[model samples]
Target: MRKNPVATKAPAEQVVKDIRRAMRKLHSSEEKIRIVLSGLRGEDSIAELCRKEGIAQSLYYSWSKDFLEAGKKRLAGDTARQASTGEV
Candidate 1:
């Protein structure tokens, strides 16, 4: 008789990792902007802000970099022309 693979138990470590991944919170774009802006305010250290926001410092820095880069690109007129409007 063949044993059922579906009845096999996953390793404990793998189960823990799966649970953690499943329970991880997903942040929205607006929430990311809010966290990034809070970090930039300078009232608190980035580490402190990250701790308060329940995120890692690396994640905060990445968001800040993206936000600033986007602003810089906008100021440089990278998207100045709309796709629907033909240039005169």
Candidate 2:
């Protein structure tokens, strides 16, 4: 294990910013879906993905539910509009 000198420690503000940057990279539903899907393809384990991405499995499930619900709503809206407008 490598140890850093206490005198050369990074500032708290910089540490916080770096942590936020890492999270921000995975801060979108599309990104989450891609990560989850890629994991499904055996590139990595779901637990590993969650760990590396700094997310909980529950959060991943919630995002999946939200994505499915959003797609359903969009499809329903499109169907209603097409029925009213006779737009096939």
In the range 1-88, model 2's lDDT, one tens digit per residue, is 6677664566866898888888754476568778657665778777787888887878777776776777798878854443555654
Which digits, one per residue and each the tens of the lDDT, describe model 1 over residues 1-88? 9887666655766899999999999999999999998888899999889999999999999999999999999999897655655654
Total clashing pairs in model 2: 0
lDDT of each: 0.89, 0.72
Those runs of model 1 whose alpha carbons end farther than 4 Å from true positions after fitting are: 1-10, 80-88
Show how many residue pairs clash in every candidate, following the order shown. 0, 0
TM-score of each: 0.76, 0.44
Stretches > 4 Å off in candidate 2: 1-26, 39-44, 78-88
Best by TM-score: 1
